[model samples]
Every structure is written in structure tokens, then in C-alpha cells.
Target: MFLRNQWYVAAWDYEVDRQPIARTICGEPIVLYRRFDRTLVAMRDACPHRLLPLSMGLKEGDNLRCRYHGLLLDSHGTALEMPHGERVTKHLCARTYPIVERHRFAWIWIGDAELADPALIPDFWPCSHPAWRFDGGYYHIKCDYRLAIDNLMDLTHETYVHQGSIGQPEILAAPIDTRVEDESVFVTRWMPDIDPPPFWRDALKRDGRVDRWQICRFIAPSSVIIDVGVAPVEAGATVENHDQGVRGFVIDALTPESATTSHYFWGMARNFDIDDAGFTARFKAQQGGVFLEDVDVLEAQQRSIEANPDMALRVFAIDVGGTRARQVIDKKLKAQGAAAS
Candidate 1:
């Protein structure tokens, strides 16, 4: 198990309301509930008083009432009242985890409490900008989280793996540049003078003129934001004009449920001024299918790794981003170990 000290997505902010939701992160079961003031609280799911799952209890105003013994727990996880005892006071409290809600997701800190900082959380650019239309969803995959991270960092696979959906075969041999910066890896590819992919074909034609294409970015350990735009194609020379269309931004994160299980959270934004609910839902579904395809391959790879733990895998130059990501993870885990010492 890796002691990743970064923000991990716990649940959708809207998923936790009046009711208490139970979630397990890094093998720790936590129960999350919202106070009347709208602040969220997370405590160990087990009640210290009777060792019962607190999630089985009820929410009463600002406290959670244990169903077995009717004990009321406050936002601080302190045992405020016990129906049978008058001597019990604030001394009894469950373990509380630091939590923050941002970008439509709840982030939980499973590491050292002092290191938990809301400001340190990664920014989901699309979620914060009003000019972008955002769509988000989740998926449960039977794969090691590292595999998912590797898959995202390696974009070359898209040409073959996602050929029908999001990939362009014409750009299969495009040159790619890779770089690593402070726990993040970036991969960029520039494709010029190519026919627009199906999704961009219609959007690229402006007043009967086709445009040039550029796919510029990919960030890691688990996020990618590509800027694709078309300009007029004339006499083998690119003419700068208004963008045919733009794929606003895409942000994705994979949270590990265990050594061989993960939860994927993804969000996409578009610059176009289209916000019909039905259209958004359909788009989300289409993007979700693409994610499912990745999940299938990742899970299979994970299973193969499990079956042959000692097998050495060969890597090519195209795996530069993935190699960098693994190095970052190794460095973080090593630093965590050194700090513990």
C-alpha cells in the first residue's frame, strides 16, 4: 500500500446531505455527515462506545444518534449525550478525519492531520471557470490505481486502443514531448494539417474553410487537458482565424479503494454555449464509455501483474510519461517513509 499524502476524492458533495454516508479510504472506514450549518464532518465509522458502525445510526439535527444505544455524537465526534448515562461527557470521541469539499467532490486526508491543507488540493480548472460547461461522473474499476495512472499518462495508446471513439489514426506517428515537474508529468503532441476527427469536423469548418489541428497537453499522475483548435488550411500554409471549436478541459482522478480496486472521477468542459440537460447527459455517457474501455484494459493488465509478480515488463520511449509518474510516486512514498523515521 502506498501512503499517498495528497487529496483523495471521497464522494460527490451532493451525495452527502442529511444522511450519513459510509466510505472507506486506505482501509479506514469513515462516516460522513453534514451539520445544520452545511459543514461536513468525518469520523471513524465505528462508535467508540459500543464498537458499532455509526453509519447505522440516525442524524438528529447537528448530531448522529446511535441506533443501538441512542448515543448522540456531535460534529467533533464527541459523545454529547448517552440516553442511559448522565456521567458520560466529551471525553468519549471517535477519530475524526480532515475533509474539504471542492470541485463538486469531497476530499479526505488519510495521512498526518497536520499536513491536511485545503489550499493544497489540486485545482480543477474547468470546474472553477464559469465560461466552461462541466460534466462529471464516476466508475468502479477492478484494477490497481497505479495502472489507471499509467494508462492516463500514456496517450499514445489512444491511437489504437480508442481508435473508433476519440483517437485519430492519422496522428498515430505524431511526435510527442514529455516532461516531469514536481510530482506532475506532461505529454504534448502537435498534429498539423490533418482532417479533423469526427467530433471536431463540423466545428472546424468556418465559412467554408477547414482549419489546422493542434492537440497540446496531458498532465499526470491522473489528469489531462488538451487544447485542440482548427485554423484555415490554405496552400499548405496555416492561416490564423477564429477557432473552429475548442475542447475546453478535462480533469480526471483515480482513488484507490484497495490494492486491486479503484474509483475513477472525471469531469470535462466545453467552450461551446450548449447546456441542454439531455445533451449533457448523452455526452457524459459517451465519455463514460471511453473510460470503460480503459478500465477493461487496465484491469486485465493488473490481473496479469498479479499472476506474475516477478515478471519484468519492457517499456518503449512512448512510455516516458508513465515512467515519470511511477518515479514521482516512488519519490513521494520514499519521502513519507523518511518522515516517519
Candidate 2:
């Protein structure tokens, strides 16, 4: 909830082609559209003239023609044409945001203009490499964005909450190590002498034998990247000669729309072949359902917290990562006088 001066994924690259799409990030309504040249642009959705939503407007060539007064806004959010005049006036323009399209997603900076740095933005797995494949999309959640981040940082809950999906019983007893650096927190757990789950059996080519496993990663205010690796098993354990084992990464970006609402944008990347349409579709569907399950629980938790704001909560060692995340958020919010904690 305190994620200001950060870049958040706004929409999938394919979602804003040739059409005006409206979204809210950090409580600010925004509109995104592409020029005829396919370059993407983003601006406050409201028209500067009358405060009307510009997303309700139309795309005329390279400009967005406001539906209210037919004002033409260029890619830079400069008012190119007003019904009453011909010269472009800087005073009659919407608040523009710096936008960039990369890795099949559109990213927007929602903070102080001077603090916008693309280099500081978290990098997506598949988006950064050609060896990986990704599925891009998002989900609207009823819970606050902080809750979504807390859920991701705490893997211990998966054993019970996601028992049917990526969860494993052995992970519950595994010891976790936590670390914090530069406002980012990371947690790592190693599970040895454990067999691969049914879903990962094919991917890892395991043969009912014990092997080293690792889940380690970093999480910032509204984003995370988890790297999961499995040690190589003996040969002839499964079909033909598949690579020793597989390593996969899960990357997510959470954007807060308001105190009680958020958008979860996530994707998975693996070293294995996910190029086939069948495999991609199956994986996306499976993971998507697991995310929905998380949404249900988090939304309920947010409601309970909202109902009892003064309730004291207890924290265990397993909650270290989540607690640290909240601390960083609280500190940032307090510095900016934003609501947090």
C-alpha cells in the first residue's frame, strides 16, 4: 500500500493495442492507448478541460480525441488540438506518466517525476531471457495490495492453503532463513531427501528418490521473484534422457488501486520447454486457479483486519519475511505521510 515512486505493471502488451484502456493505480485513474506506430502512451484518464474520463474518448490516428470536447491529446499527453483553437497549449493537457512497454507488459511510473528510474525497476524472468516462456495477464482482488504481497512472502501457508497445487507436506517442517537488504526481503528454504510432487515429476524427471531442493528469492513492496531449483536425479529414472533437473521462477507485480483493492499481475518462467500450446495452456489454467484460491483467503483476511483495526497480532518466526515487508512499507509511508501500518 505504500508503493509510491515505483513502477508497476499496468497492462499486458496485447491488451492496449489500438484501443483506450482505463485502469487505476495507486488510486489514480489512468488511460493507456497505442499510437498508429504501435508505441504505447499513458496519462491521467481525466480530461484537463472538464475532468471527463478520456478513456471514454476515441483514438484518432496518433492522438486520443476526447469524447467530451473532441480535444486531441498526443502520445506525450500534450493537447494537440482544442475545438476552440488551433495552436497546441501546454496549459490544457492531462497529467502524463512515463510509460514503457517491455516483456509483453506496459509499465507506468506512479511517483515523483524525479524518482522515476527504469533501471531500478524489478526485472521479470521470462521477459529478461529467451530461454523462458511466460503467460501475461492480471487479476483484480478485493483485498489491499499489501495482503497480496504478504501472502507471497510467506511460503509456509502454502502447505495448507495450496495443498492441491504447488504445496508439499515436507515444506511445512523445512527450516527457513530470512534476510533483509536495501528495503528488500528474501527467504530461503532447502528441502532435501524429498521426492518431487506429481505436477513436477515430469518436469524434473524424478524417480522416487531424495534430492536437494531450494526456494530462494527477494520481494519488494509490490513485486517478487522466487527461484525454485531441484537437484539432478539418477539417469534412467524416467523417460529417455531429460536434463538432470529443472529450475523455475515465479515473478509477480501487485498494484494497489485503493486502500481496499488491488490488481495482481503475475507470470511463471521455467527452463523446461513450455513452448507447446498444450503445455502453456494447461500450466496457465492450473496456476491461475491457485491464484484465485489465494485471492479468496486474502480478501477475507483484509475484511477481518478492517473490522478490528486495533486488534493485536502475534508473529512467529515463519512470519519474519512478511513482518519485514510490512516494516519497510510502514517506514516508506511514514516518510511520505502516506497511510500505512
Question: For candidate 1, what is the TM-score?
Answer: 0.87
**Per-residue C-alpha lDDT of model 1 across residues 1-341, encoded as one tens digit per residue:** 65655678887777788789887776788898888888888889998878789999988887888888888888788888876877777788888989998877888888778888888777776676777778778888888777777777666777777877667775567777777767567766656656666555544434433343433233323444544445445534332333444544666777777778877887677676556677678878978888888988988898898899899667788777677777777777788888888
Tell me the lDDT of candidate 1. 0.72
- Most TM-score-accurate candidate: 2
Question: Superposing all C-alpha atoms, what RMSD in Å does each candidate have to the true structure?
Answer: 3.3, 4.0
In candidate 2, the residue pairs with backbone N, CA or C atoms under 3 Å apart (3 or more residues apart, or in different chains) clash, namely none
TM-score for each model: 0.87, 0.90
lDDT (CA) for every model shown?
Answer: 0.72, 0.77
lDDT (10s digit) by residue, model 2, range 100-198: 887777889998878788886676746668777777457999888877777888887878888886678888888887888887888877666677665
Clash-forming residue pairs, model 1: 211-231, 212-231
Candidate 1: residue 209 lDDT (0-100): 39
Misplaced by over 4 Å in model 2 are 84-89, 210-216, 232-244, 337-341
